[model samples]
Target: MKFTTKWMAAYFPEYKGAADTEIPIHHIYTDTRQKTDRGLFVPLEGETFDGHSFLKSAINNGAVAAFWNKEKPIPEFVPTDFPLFLVDDTLIALQQLAHTFRTEINPKVIGVTGSNGKTTTKDFIASVLSQNYKTHKTKGNFNNHIGLPLTILSMDQTTEVLVLEMGMNHFGEIERLSFISEPDVAVITNIGESHIENLGSREGIAQAKTEILAGLKSNGKVIIDGDEPLLAPLHTREGVLSCGFDEKNKFVLSDCKMDDTGTRFTINQNINYMIQVPGNHNVKNASFAIIIGELLNMNQEHIQEGLSSIELTGMRLERITGKYGTTILNDAYNASPTSMKASIDVVKELPNFSRKILVLGDIFELGALSEMLHRSIADAISEPIDMVIAIGEEAPYIVEEMKKKELAIEAHSFKTKEEAVDILESTLSEETVILLKASRLMEFETLLEHLVEKE
Candidate 1:
């Protein structure tokens, strides 16, 4: 964010005043409510509201300048001498400015995308690389079209490595992100049914995830999950690095073990590694980080140190103590059938717990196959699981399937999390370990709060 308005005018020549102004813009802001100090406000136009309306508010809040949409009328209150970059579209201008800044900084960019685990994978890669290099990564939920550009723009010029998470609900979204990033190393976590509502099927999801390759550097390397049959076509491609439990993968994860403490696994059958995060999926996530570390020429000791001291984003299988002395695995950040099963598997693996409870919720965006997909989770549940509390509109499908199986487990279905909370408040105890998981809309994390407050 060290660019000047003079530099920005080079890409966007149409400006109202003072193209040679020496204003150093250290921040790019979109939201007017946020504090904007020496910031350049880029007004984005949406279906419901136009950001152009907030230009004056942004300027009042410390924005040095703004990007004005040419289609909109200029406010008569504003002076002509005030700095404004007139563009056909403010959103496109923001992207163009971000691209220009990225080219100038010239850091080694890594783009991560998938149906699940994109955020965790990005965090893992950034943590490992930061041990040896000045690394910057996407913060918070900023991994989309606007988020990605802002992530790049937010990076320090001295950053040696940049890791960005790419998220998409439909086709071509990843392509646009990739084109902006031009990644030197692209990692596809795995193909799942996350956006099956819009993308059609697992095959369609795979195709959409592969769009990350659209802007990959000519000599870039691709790291993927070889265990997925949908990605089998990439097994033989040059510069493609595969990591998974499958033997065919170039970097195979073997001899795995997990507990409440963490997970231990071997890479390539010889190198031992441990990550603080639970679940086999997280172990696979660390494997991708290991590959990226190696490609960056980081030594094994440094990489292992990085892996052992991993800092993950919150609500991804995080083990927290409950008010009742029970354990709460707050993994309610997001859910897909694959991720929900993975989280459940982690719950089952934790030892010393007398009762393992799974408070599950709906997985969104499954299209017409939502019911069948929701029921499919039953295939993963087994013994050691004492109770299953399904929440949300589509979660009852899981309960129905569980009942049909007739397993020796208690199952209850609730239309809302509020109803589920009443049962959990009385049921949870010191020996209980409960997992809360669902899509972002379900807000399953609030249930964990209720458990903590009851005591």
Candidate 2:
């Protein structure tokens, strides 16, 4: 049964039931567009537009209930029959409701946070945990403040394990999400060069990621990346499980091989395992899951089997055939210099490629280190790439670095994505290995979509 108003009000004392004490909402929705019969719509504020304007349409589309800001005039379109979950702020109300749901649902929560691989790690853990239990995970990039709440509230009563990816950009964001989640187990994938603009340094980012522990279960297990020097100190917590390539890790990954298809590796105490993903980082992420599986007394084979199952989110270093028969490593999800370089390495290692091409856009949030970090990507382009297409303001520095190093590879800079795509379309060869690496704001996926369609 969907969450009734009764259980929601139990923990949310703020919840005042309908006139007779029955405020039944069949479903919850953040997007007004999806509002349907018995839908509780929470109108969010965005930078470009206010969702309040859409409330009328939401009800027209069958929204039976809505969370409206007291400031806005109630739209005439919504019939008097519908109830408005009135609040000072709709977002906070949604978060509070989700917080209440967690107390009621009591799922075995596994929260993951880090600078780089949280989503991948979350997916890996969910796959492994799903083998023996009903598992739910944050889908796509829904790991932010509002998204996390929605993800939590959506879990059913039967949800055995809920894998939540808790991502944060600034100080205390992870803390907020963690308090809402209060995970039974917390995983830190690694502290990488992501969101360095706002946080200032990799160390600062590490501190932000570690805030996941603030709301962790008192006896919860903390799984960390032992290979990351920045994260190594975090294992001081008792019952912490360290997983990485290092021998000292509780779950050590060795004999790793990465191909265009996937990576193969073996855990120290477990049989050989392979994951259908390209990167040592991914193997590390999967290793965390293997350790957790062992802790929960799950079938070891199922853990490996679970790792082998499940498709990852798109635009995350995905390998796909594109136009002109190009093999594209579409890594446009979001990027840092670290991830960009990793994708380059993955593409460079792929066999039988006639020409290696790196289509790199700007890495956002490097702060003062943006130029140096962008230029540093040139160092990663060793022998494999025939040409480097650098886009955005940082492209010039990347090209200059490539030239100073006396690399014979061709370097092209474009401020506009149109010119970049035109060059990619006309110059791309049949056997070229094209790697698309960029930040989410750069819209690199548009080029990827075009390239894929042309193929």
Candidate 3:
């Protein structure tokens, strides 16, 4: 059980009915459609919908208590004895409750933020830390203001480590999440171009990402990318450990190797590590986990075990066997110029693929730099890459740039994913490997529905 109604009453005293009852609340839910066990329903208001209207559905789905907006009238249907905590803003009340619950459980919080690999890094950290601790991590894309609180509130009382992936599109967002999480360990994966349109430049992005430090506990540990020039200022800070391929980092990575299976690398020229995912970028992400494991005094054996058995979120460099034995690298969860290029490089390095095709799509939030940034992806495409099938509005720039190179590779452009599905299906074969990448708006995973081999 998470907490009792009596326990929650201590935090929210302005409530009516059953305030003294010891009814257990095992879950906290927002969506009325999701069934819960003794849940506390939080009615959230959005642009097009108000969850307040569905309190009856929440009640039918096992919501024992709920937070009602003070502006809304107590519905005539609501039982007079049912617990209803009145609040001016249900969202803020939810956040405050989560903060109190987090303090009560008192897990060692780890806040991870970066342009690209925050989710993957959160997975790595949680996997490694769970080897020696009762760990809980942010689920799916639940890293925003609402999602982070829900993630915290969802954790069991026994959790010893709380791993949160923090995401943002503008400034001050990470600061708000950091303050809510109050992490003991803050990790800045790397400074990339993920939200350059809103943040302005790589430096601005770094500033926004580093807002995770705003709520860091005194004497807390900080992990960062030593290779990123924007984060170089923190290289010498007390209790800060930098991890990267650069020799100057506190935890240096080298001797990296990748193949069809995964990546192998060594840290500080002594400890060797292997992860089931292939890419130098992944190596850096794994290094952040290794540093955290060491800081927590985990044995090298457990760290290795964690990395070897790591399971990533879907649509992230996932390898699938397609029709006619074709290989599909679905990195289509989301994309930016930096990540798209990184995905392209991973495909370029893999061996034994006679036909390597790139099914590229537009990257969003690029603002005025969309054309130039899309064109820059072609810089990573060269020899051994047999075909480039570009789709979406700005993705055609990638093909246009490749055509300027006049290489022997086949390059095609289509305005939409539907237009390219037939060509992608025909190109699949035993020797061919295809990489699919795009922004979340592109819904590139739908393309997989047509390409994945069905039983």
Candidate 4:
């Protein structure tokens, strides 16, 4: 990012510094621990940690400048002539800088958001768009407020297409990110019971997710999951393209087939598509990318290559071999009731596994409906799953509900991951496929590691 020190004056006019020199800032950094060179450090204040405490470390680690909160006293460690963009809040200043940089570069931005498939869809869109354009997308799971700005600032000046993942837990969050991104094209993957605790119901969740349309460009197009009844309101909206298995969708999904390797599907019988990732849901995720690719005028061959060559973000159904010759589907990145069921459905479809084991943990943030949502996962379990190993505070309810329903699947529940591992390791075999999925707080990756290491 080539930003002049003088340019900072535009967003922060009160920025007290020499405005003559055009200093090029190569990077923008928040965490002092991460290695940075000639970067602008933006100190943020939070409840548990204060980034202002790390300013000296940031400067020592090669930060050429920083955004200084005007309310806070200037630290003495800095030289009198050092560049400090002064603002009321450093975090807001960082956002302002990113917004300014975005305007200067003026890349076509695509915003993607959903309860389950945001990361996968972002990867799909980026992979496909990058085949034809200089594309940059949200890195990892950094889709929140701070992460979104950081993503924008991190983009190269030459970037032609910018794909951003907009994530939220409550109202107004997506609206803030949408306004910040000013997306030329917006995609809402689906609205599910992700943050029912805060959003109340599926209707409320849908309301929160639709905030992406707030800052959508007047001429921008919208692609959505038409199968969702909650999204039916978007059906008649102008410039909105719907993609789903439903025939009512503009790009109808059809003839989906999946195995251990991947998924093959067709859209409207006009194009046949395949994804390296397995899941009917992932095929849905790929459908969003396909629509975006067409909107960008990318050719069919390039679009095919992009979807077929997808590399999903870590821990999202990542395949790994266990020490006992078991196949581990490490989807511990995150989980909502909807996502959990989707993962379970994918595991059910995989062929050649003699035994299918589902290691599910609690789906957090369900509010009053936590138990109900937890119990709903049991509905997805059947003969395809030989055993269900559940861990977490809410997991026992799953086992209880399954027993009540007499699902006929062997089930076990543990309050902690440590307790579950012993039984999990004992059951592993050459034909076993274990799927670990939970909320990020559960840290189920540790179980994945244990299974991978156990002989």
Using TM-score as the measure, what is the rank order of every candidate, best first?
A: 1, 3, 4, 2
For candidate 1, lDDT tens digit of each residue in 300-399? 9999888877788999888888867889999999999999999999988888899999999999989899999999999889998999999989998998
**lDDT tens string, model 4, 156-194?**
989999999999989999999998899999999988899
Clashing pairs in 1: none
lDDT, candidate 2, 313-409, per-residue tens: 8877777877767778888888888777778877777777888888889888898998889889888987877889988887568888999999999
Model 3, span 400-420: residue lDDT tens: 998897767899999998999
Clashes (backbone N, CA, C under 3 Å), per candidate, total 0, 2, 0, 0
Q: What is the lDDT of residue 215 in candidate 2?
A: 93
- Number of the candidate with higher TM-score, 2 or 3: 3
- How far residue 149's Cα lies from its native spot in candidate 4, in Å, is 0.3
Which parts of model 3 are misplaced by more than 4 Å? none
| Candidate no. 1 TM-score | 0.98
TM-score of each: 0.98, 0.91, 0.97, 0.97
Candidate-wise lDDT, in order:
0.90, 0.81, 0.92, 0.89
Residue 386 of model 2: what lDDT?
84
